[model samples]
Target chain A: MINAVGREIPDEILRMTGKEPFQGNSYKEGVPFRRYAPIIRPVMDNTHNKMVKDIHEALVKCKAHNGMTVSFHHHFREGDLVVCMVMEEIHKMGLKNITLAATSLGKAHDALVPMIEDGTITSIQASGVRGKIGEAISHGKLKNLAIMRSHGGRVRSLVTGETKVDIAFIGAPTADEYGNLRGVGGKSNCGVLSYSHVDGDCAEYVVAITDTLVPFPNFPAHISMTKVDCVCVVDAIGIPEKIATGAAKPTTDQRKLMMAEYCTQVVVNTPYFKDGFSYQTGVGGASIASTISLTKIMEERGIKMGFGVGGMTKPMCDLLDRGLCRVLLDTQAFDLDAVTNILNPKHHRITAGSYANPFNKGAFVNKLDYVILASLEVDVHFNCNVVVGSDGIITGAQGGHPDTAQGAKCTIVICPLLQGRIPAICSEVTTVTTPGESVDIVVTDYGVAVNPNRPDLLKALEEADCVPLKTIEQLRDEAYAITGVPNPVEFGDRIVGIIEARDGTIMDVVREIKD
Target chain B: MEILKPAVAGTLESSDCMVTVEPGQGKVNLDLDSSVMRQFGPQIKKVIAETLARLDVTDVNIRVVDKGALDCTIKARVEAAVYRSNDIRKDIPWGGAIK
Candidate 1:
């Protein structure tokens, strides 16, 4: 079946997953459903000690078994060590057919490839997969299909019980003996534990693994003791330096600066660029440069941002420091500056479910007026691909691209026309991760293209006459003229991954890359 | 034009290709390794062949390591390597032989 973005979702996949193809962005809007609650074993006595000896004991206490779904969070990113520690313990216990449901996975988890081959992990679910594990999955090493959801969609799946996690292993920076966890005040502080909140709430059993065991009542817990079932102390949860890096420096690349300038013009020219506008942007060089460029304009016009949200970075935090923004609602801190800046009274932490989940009462993204995003590729249809590279490898994540794009009133994607010899603006993307209906504008060094669905925005840009405007087809042709047309990436018949829409519908399928 | 000695041109940069040319066994021999080999390998080879054909060099061994260079960059590098193989530096036709 063809999805709304024109990608063909195989009927077999639809029947197997028991989900509908993406009809449109608002297909599930106003739809009603009941939230799934996990079976809990309440702590009725004060003598119960949730502390466990080690990971093995934690698994035993949680009842390690075959064919069980376990969950993890990616707050530690590339520096994470808990995934490997927990999975190795599970493999040692002779567990088989286990499904690994993580919020995201990176190169740090490549050690699990051996287990994937040995059949300890037969299925996988995450926001994205990278490194050797992605290559393993692309080569059909896993026994079952992998499901890739956005950060928002992952929360929706957990909330609706579509993916019921039997056990959740949360790597906390700090945890008390009673299982109260905090993101700060630990050796390997990552600033926030937003993504694991849902897992703690919905999982049948929750384990808090921490390197630092603080004193009791780790006050203002990010994950409360009431939801935690066990506490396991480890030597280290993550490498502190790798968990959060230094501040991102502004870009000196001329092409990126040009696109950044164009993005600023687009933002300022649009009607949504008013006082107290809500904005979100990634931490890419171009995005940071765009934020810097926009900051100048905001300062000049004396306009203050109502709030800045998403993966917080130095540039956005600088906005708060300069009083250019009123508040910073951070889900994940991308740098050391952001991590240290969270101590500010105005910089508040939020859960991932409240940040982007479509099924929630309302997500922060829905209140966004402008969102500047980066893409691996953007088709003429304005559909963006962030998960798959031009080589048909799952090298990136759909972190909040789909959720924020659908929620923001004006969605602007900033990208260079060409990435090396490959054209970033093409006839079609490798996959559709963000549907075109949600995208309003695409800013490239060559020119800016407005989605035809957003003619009002086109009119606004034209009337303002601030930036060079061209049809998306023109930008694509200019790119092809320079780089030549690209041949289609070869793929095998077996499906390797499924991209889920934020509303719990199938958006696209990733086939095994042909060897 | 004829190959006099081995010569090289271009650098291994993001949007550039390194081309090496030397005397061959009486026939054109081209070897290519590109980051975009899966997508634009044939087109890159076609550009090299066409550029060599225009230069009238029929028997030479050329090796190209491409980091996603455009057609123009490929042509310019291939032409420069062909000219440098014969030590022809001065009085070089900027547009005639190159274009």
Candidate 2:
């Protein structure tokens, strides 16, 4: 069945998952609820004493058995070591058929590929997958269909009981024996423990794994001991350098600079370009370039942004420090500078749920005036494919792309005309990660294309008339003229993964790569 | 335009192709390994062959390790490899080969 966005969701898949097809952005109207249950805590001799000797002890005590779900957070990104360590321990203990529910998975967790093949790790639910693990899942080595959810969607899944996490192994940079956790103040400071907050709250067993154990009452804990069930200390939580870079540099590419220039000009001409306007941008080079360009534009106009939100980066931090943006509602810190700056007074750390959860009453993304993001491929219709590549392999994550695109008054997708030889703009993306209606503008190195749905934006851009603007079809045709039309990818009958939009509807399905 | 010696171009990065072209015995011999082989191996090979044919170079051994590069990228890399192998820098048919 075709969804509202025109993505074909196989009936077999619909029958299997019991998820309705995406019925556009306004599908959900009423309040969503979960069956309430009181916390049935174990009778502990001392409530404050929850330290376990090792992961083995924690798993045994938590009654972690085969065929149960386990979760992890990607705060550490490529530096994370806790997931592999815990999986190794689980394998040693003969635990099998476990579902690995992670906020996101990256190259750091490539070691799990063999485990997935061995049936020790049978299922995966994550925002992103990369490296060998992605190859493993794409090849259909795993026993169950991999479920890809946006960050907001993941929280919604947990809260709505669609997915239940048996144990949440949160890798905290710093923690106490009583299970108080913080992302900073450790040997490997990642800044925000926000992604793990929902898991800590919803999971049946919550364990805080840390390399640095502080004294009692880890003050103003990002995750309190109230929700934590056990604490385990490891040699290291993550590779410090890989977790957060020392600096987040903006792109200096000339073509990308032009795109950024256009993005900035579009914002300045928009109705929401006044003082105290809001902003959000992802961590891509082009997006950051746009943000950096915006700083100059804001300076020239003496306009200060009201707030900046999303994954905190150093450029956004610089804006706050320079008094261009009044506040930063950070979900996850992306660099060393961001991690340190988020500890400051003006930068406020927020949970992932509060950052972009679609089902929530209010989200930081909903109030944004502008959001700049990058895409792997965007069709003429403006439907984006940030999840699957041209080859039909899942390589990217849909972090806050859809949520912010739908919420922000103007969402600009910035990219070059082509990535290598593949056209960034296509007739139809391999997967519809973000629907066209939500997208407002498509900005590329060559020209800009305003979604026809937004005639208001088109009129504003035409009046400003500073940047080169073209129809989306023209851009797509220009790209294809350079790179000949690509052959369609052949996929196998087995559905390897399901791409879920933020509202729990099936946006697209990734099938096994045909041999 | 014929490949004179062994030459290489491109990278193993995602959306890129690592292509090595060498002079062969009057016939095209292609050795390809791709991450997207199941879905695009044949297409990658076709792009390579068509690119070489456009350059009018059939006596070449093309070794490609494609990381899901687009056809245009594959064509560009093939042209670069052929030019580099032949040590031809001036008056090269760049646009024609790419087309």
Candidate 3:
């Protein structure tokens, strides 16, 4: 079956996931919102001590059993230990057919691979899947089709109760005995637990796992005690060092610098580059460098940005501190600098639902004027692949790529034309994680390609004397000429993972990689 | 082409690699240390060899401490190191070497 973006979804996959193919943007305009009403229970006492000895006791209190959905947050990134620890106890109790709905999964969760293979963990729903867990999923270890959702999509689905979470295990850096949790003021300080807020609201049972237990009231709590039902004290929730290990820095490489400059050129040339513009850029060498260049350009023009949003980085925070940007709406802090900045009142911490949930009346992304994103590969049609790698393996995540791209007035994708022998600009992307319609421009070291759908952007670039513009096909040809045509990835018939658009429609599917 | 002295290029960072080249015995002795050696060792080596071949240089000791750099980056660093060793900064054959 051909999706709205014209990607072919196998018939077997359609039957397995039973989801509608993506029918382009606004296709969900008339779609009905799933109504949900959870059973409300009032706290009878002010004991301020909901502490449990271990995860087992917490699970017992939550009425843990087989065939239940459990959720975790990936704010800790690769250093997270809560997911594995919770799954280990569940496995030890002989609980099978468990659904692990996490915001994302990284190498830290590799310990769950054996659980997946042994059928201890039966389902997975996440924005990111990598390392051993990704390999297991790619080989079709899970009984059900692996569901992938962007940060916004995950929030929307959870809030609407389309996917009921039985238990949401939140890893808080600091929490009081009463269950008031703060991301900071603890041994392991992660910036914000924004992603878990919806889980806390939707889950039947909410557990707060913490390493450092503060006093009676953890002031300035990210998750209030009212939302948390139980608290589990662990020796450690995550490795602080590894949690923010790959905080991206501006690249010194000339090729990346060139692309970053070009990205800035697009922004500076755009009609929306006036005062009070909003911006967002992801964490990567090129993307980080682009942020730096963008700020410099803004400073030179003496035009202040209204606000910066999305995953906060050091460069973005610097702009906020320098008064180049009025405010920073941070959902997840990508580094220590960002984490520290979130403490300041000027940098407001926001929830995941308010950040990008399309169903919401207002999202920060909707106010964005410019958003720069990274891509593993981009096709001539402007569709991007940030999920699967060249070897047909799941190595990346959707995160907020699609959400910000759709929300921003000008969405620029900056990447090198080639990665190794693989062409970053290709005939067609390996998987369409972000639809082409949302993409406005593709900036490479070779040249910049504006999406044909975005004629205004093309006209703006053309009007700029310094901007070098090229056709998307020309960029793809240039990449092929240098790297040569790549061999098509061989995929097995079994569908392993299903990519969900921000609207909860099927965007693409990743099949099993052939050994 | 013969290297005049030891030269180095690139930096040891994630998704980047540092390459050091020195004059060696008649045979090219390559020393590689990479985080992604298990998956991309062979490919990295092949890139190094191709880059050297493009520069028309051989019989050198090349050391690479790779941090998961792509082939283009590896090639660019290799070409830069070779050019630095030869002290040939002016009139670099950019198109030929990069291709």
Candidate 4:
């Protein structure tokens, strides 16, 4: 079946996953379903001890078995040790057919490639995968198809009982003996545990792994003891330096600055640029430059942002610090500056469910006025691809790109016309991670294009006449003129992965790349 | 043009390609590995083949590790590798065989 974005979701895949094709962004509007509840082992006796000696003991206690789904979070990013540590134990235990469910996976978890090959892990589910694991999956090494969900979609799956995680291992920066975990006051401080909040609440068994074992109460916990079933102390959960790197300085690249200027013009000229507007942006060089450019305009016009959200970066945190923004709802901290800024009262931590889950009553993304995102590619249809690269490899994550784009009033995607000799604007993206209907504007180094679906925004930008505007088709043509139209990537018949929309519908399928 | 010894041109930088050439067995042989190979592999090979044909280098072994280089850059690198293989450094063709 052809999805709303014009991508074909094979009938075999639809029948296998029992999922509907993405009809449109609002197909799930006003839909209702009962919340899926996990089997709870209530602790009423006072004699039970929650502290475990090591990961091995925790696995045994959690009944780690073959084909069970284990969950993890990516709060530690590249510095993460928990996923490898736990999986190594699981592999040593001779477990087979285990499903690894993570919020996200990166280069740090490349060690799992051997496990994926050896049948220790047969299935994988996550927001996305990168590094060798992605290559391994793309090469059809895994026994089962990988399910790729957006940040919001992950929560929706867990909530709707589509995915049942048997064990959730949370790598907490600090934890008490009774399993009260906190994100700060530890050696490896990664500002917020926002992504794991849903894991803690939805998993059948939740284990808290920590390097810093704080005093009994670890009060002001990010993951309360109520949801935690056990606690384990490790030597190191993550490397602090790698958990959150240095701040992202504004870009000095002229093309990026020009795109940033054009992005600022679009934001300011749009109807959602007034005071009390909410905003989100990625940590790309162009994205940071856009924030800087938008900051100057906001400062000049005395327009204070209502709230800034997403993976918190230094620039966005600086806006909160300077009182240019009223609040900073951080889901993850991208830098050490953002980690430290969480001490501010107004800098709040939010759960992944409240951050972008479409099934929730209201998510912060729903209130967003503007979101500046970076894309690997944008097609003539304005659909953005953040996961797959031109080489037909899954090299990036969807993060909150789809959610924010669909939620925000004005979703602006900033990308250069060409990445090296490969055109970033094409007739069709290698994969559609964000449908064109959600994206309102495409700001390239060459020019900006507004989605024809959003004529109001198009008219508003034209009326202001402050920025160069073109149709998305024109942008794709100009890109092709510089880099000749590329041949489509060859693929095998085996479907390796499925890209799910935030509403739990199949948006696109990733086939095995021909070697 | 004739193959003399092994030679290389260009760097493995973004928007650049490294071309290596050596003596072959009476036929043109090309091996290509590119970052953008899935999309531009055939196009890059066509440019390299055209460049080699223009220079009349029939018996040579060529290898290209492309970092998303353009067609023009691919041609220039291929020509540079061919010229360097024959140790030709003086009065080289600029817009003639090189283009």
Candidate 5:
């Protein structure tokens, strides 16, 4: 932990921009929990019966005696049931202290809460925790630290040998004995197999679980049979229709669209409008609409982007159809349209670790020329807060915002000037997800604000005659002046939770509000 | 020795480009139609991964024919090809398992 204001800087960064005492709350991505996947022989072989049989055998073999770490993929999103069923059997067997290392822990796995209480499970580590499980863990119910990772960071941890899965449970839309699998059938599917692909490759034992047990060869599969052990068969695997409704949706706010317009103008004026530029946009309405508008701008200018990264949406798909963006590197499907597209055979899909994490050997987000995101609040200094609120409440959660902001060459945060009576421009953010250093600009409905460090971006926007430009401090003062001073939030010393940096360090703690 | 055809024309079949692998004999490469291929890279990869396994077509060349399948769809097709190559039945469930 090199002191921000306390000491010297790292040689690599210091050489480019000399070291100084740091005072700001900044983070560095930490050691990953999972290790990198190298070509390894399958620990067990069960290719003849079917992919299901092979999956089961591998899990049983990997955790031979039980009480070990096991993992699963959330590619099924809200439609998933493999993890719960796998755990039910494990719980039935009375296994204790089992650790679940999932790509991201979803509410579908809420049954594990019982296991956590019964001592069958004691720890959890994943990309993000949502819904009921998030609530339970937040109330200090769990006995262990809930380490959240970016998709890329998770891949890196696994690849770097930080987090090792004794057994990995994989579910497919369809599968064969040779361990071939795909996601295009049943109640809900059309998601990436990237998460499972990584888990299967890294875990010591791999269990293939599915409802659709196809013929001798389950044509097209992501998890290769050679890397699989035994397959487990269940009546059905997904929650039918869940693939459509599993995601958080965008809000139809006029102000948001206006902000999106300004964000698009920022891009049109930036260095990302080239014919073959690559970019990423978050699932927020502003980001999505900005991408939508930007695509039209691209079409108007006859410019085609090289690639796009996302959980994905209809707007993103529309661009791809129009020959605007070249590819969509998908890790998670954030909307129904994305799920539908994923089911089709034309969209470009990628792994979670491969799409957003920095630790991965080659993540797609790192190559992005620009990335658009959202924040609950952005301070005058450009530090952003997405996991906490001004009232000291943990209303927001860190999704992929931080990782993308830090990875992209040009990071643009889009939001409204004011949320209801509360001003979005603040003197200091309640919490910092992406440091001011990583943030290049903030595009609000009224205007655009550039970080002090990015003078070039500031100059470019000025030359373009796009939107009103201002420093973040001026914006904050104007917002406060317009909305009257906000009532100061009271705080107590009792910490509720810790927001983790991608690298596994505690960036900041959410303190209990003193009422 | 097996060439799997797509169900629709200018659909999956028309998506095929070229595979000019350098040192890696097992790798698949193509000078893809960026606007088309990029949007469907994720889906295309999914179809291919599954088809490759089902066809039992290991260490072989895979030429894609894409028509803007999302990331997941791409993976599924290649896997189908893999299964078809091995003459394995393609009538298995590729969906998730219910609780």
Candidate 6:
């Protein structure tokens, strides 16, 4: 089931090891590629005319063709200019069938449609896409599947050679001529250079594009210049304002606030209730709403949270900033503010393996005091699904839903009983991201349901008159009453893609049903 | 809406009678300067830990100082403390209980 660059992995590493190793044994000796030396130089002297001449020469050598994979990172998030600018050059070069292998797509790449239509690029595989480009991809304008990978998965893919990049276009937030980069010192400052680190190690040619060219040795460097090839200085790398606010704001809907209240109540009544206890909440409207309310309850009752987990966001960033939570064990920064705050030392940006890979020797998830996540549907059996709805269409992305759910002390799912015309509770979930075993509570605006296994919570909440605890069946029925349960989706069996656990075993297969 | 605020393990504040939670061991000797909160601190932390300890706990480290905070306030703070410190939260041999 696992292969890297036409060579099958030894069974000892694949089968004997219980945890599928997501990261390459960057430490262990493995097959190394033969070097194909190309003309490379860091533009320490941008004022010197030789630097521009080198870039023009390098561009001439990397002449493109159909299906040629190109990669970039969103260190600048919405502020990026290199991808579009490089695409303009590719368009000028009249290249077609190019697939953009980005670590993560950003709103800044919205300019790709003209290139997409003109056949300069063909496909994508990264965390998620947004803005006009996302709309374009969602409409199935591209010929191939829009492969979505989590932050860690992208790094894993690039390193393992599952996806090879012909040329990695790295736009530094701050870098010196010798190519050492740091986001904190530069003007843009979006912390966490984990994405580009992998690309630089694997890609054939890595081009460094920068606006702020520091000294030869940049301070607090994330990516060393040794991996970088050609250096190109631009007028500006990105626009700061647009990249900072894209996914920062939380929803303030009254119903969302109502739902958040019930969620906070679950945390309030749980056994983990104590000073310095830790937990994680989703970036969704309902989960963030609960976090803010939980923050208020903590403030009111003179409590402080220990650590926050999973996908980090702005409000959670607020909790981190206020000293409400001591540390943010962040795997992925879900919004602009998180990216910005991660720039500040107040928040920490962690690699995927450190944050959620269950196979790791000591992952932070295993030490979580509590974990609260959002869900698409829950069933009477208590199984939860985040990837698909009743229609079985892929509505959700498997962000960190399963990994943290597996490790937290008190896992709660905070969601509305119903959404749109679909019931949030159903006979069975369309997909299972988190098995119900780890989940301890399900909170809705109307009531809360403690897992049968957690009867003490049930008993105490009963005494405390915490939100009424009902059977999962009752929650589903309530949702059904509001919006009748939809029929199950019919599907075809040509597996479009497979969802594998970090250990690389195929957990589930997503088949492509006729559109 | 009579929202239920939970109290986890923490310290006592004497002046405003507020319980404070500082990051560290799951339990702390609750100390307070204000005369009003003199009765709290260690008393609440001890009571809350023994109460929740009936449920499975892999680890806990907490520090708290309290002043005349109500039972509700104490419980809310205690819950927050427990939820943040330890994460070994699966198939708790048993989970729901109260002092």
- Considering just the first chain, candidate 3 attains a TM-score of 0.98
**lDDT per residue, candidate 2, A178-277, as tens digits?**
8889988999888898889888878998999999999988978999988898999989889988987435576777888888888899889989999999
Q: What is the interface RMSD of each candidate, in Å?
A: 0.6, 3.6, 5.5, 0.9, 20.7, 23.9
Give the C-alpha miss distance for residue A309 in model 3, angstroms: 0.4
Sort all candidates by lDDT, best to worst: 1, 4, 2, 3, 5, 6
Please give the DockQ score of every candidate, comma-separated.
Answer: 0.83, 0.36, 0.08, 0.79, 0.01, 0.01
How would you encode candidate 1's per-residue C-alpha lDDT over A129-235 as one tens digit per residue? 98989889888898998988999999999999999999999999999999999989998888999999999889999999999999999989999999999999999
Which lDDT tens digits does candidate 6 get at residues A167-241? 887777787876777655566655566567667777777777777788777866677777776677777777766
Local accuracy of candidate 3 as per-residue lDDT tens digits, A1-515: 89978888877777766678898978876566765645656788765457889999999988999999999999998889999999999999999999999999989988898898888888899997989888888878888778888999999888778789998999999998888998888888888999999887888989999999888789888999888889999999999988776577668989888888888888888899999999998888888888888887887889999999989889998998898988888889888888778877889888999999887776889889999999999999899999898767898889999899888989999978877556899998988999999999999989999999888878878878666789999999998776556667778988888899998888998888886
Span of 10 residues, lowest total lDDT, candidate 5 chain A: A13-22
**Candidate 3, superposed: residue stretches over 4 Å from native:** A46-49, B1-99
Q: What is candidate 2's CA lDDT for residue A142?
A: 89
- Which structure among the candidates has the greatest DockQ? 1
Indicate the DockQ of the complex predicted as candidate 3.
Answer: 0.08
Residue A13 alpha-carbon offset, candidate 3, angstroms = 2.7
Clashing pairs in 2: none
- Model 2 docking grade: acceptable
Candidate with the greatest TM-score versus the true structure = 1
**What DockQ results for candidate 5?**
0.01
Per-candidate TM equals 0.97, 0.92, 0.86, 0.97, 0.72, 0.65
- By lDDT, the better pick of 2 and 5 is 2
> How much native contact recovery, as a fraction, does model 6 achieve?
0.00
In terms of docking quality, model 1 is high
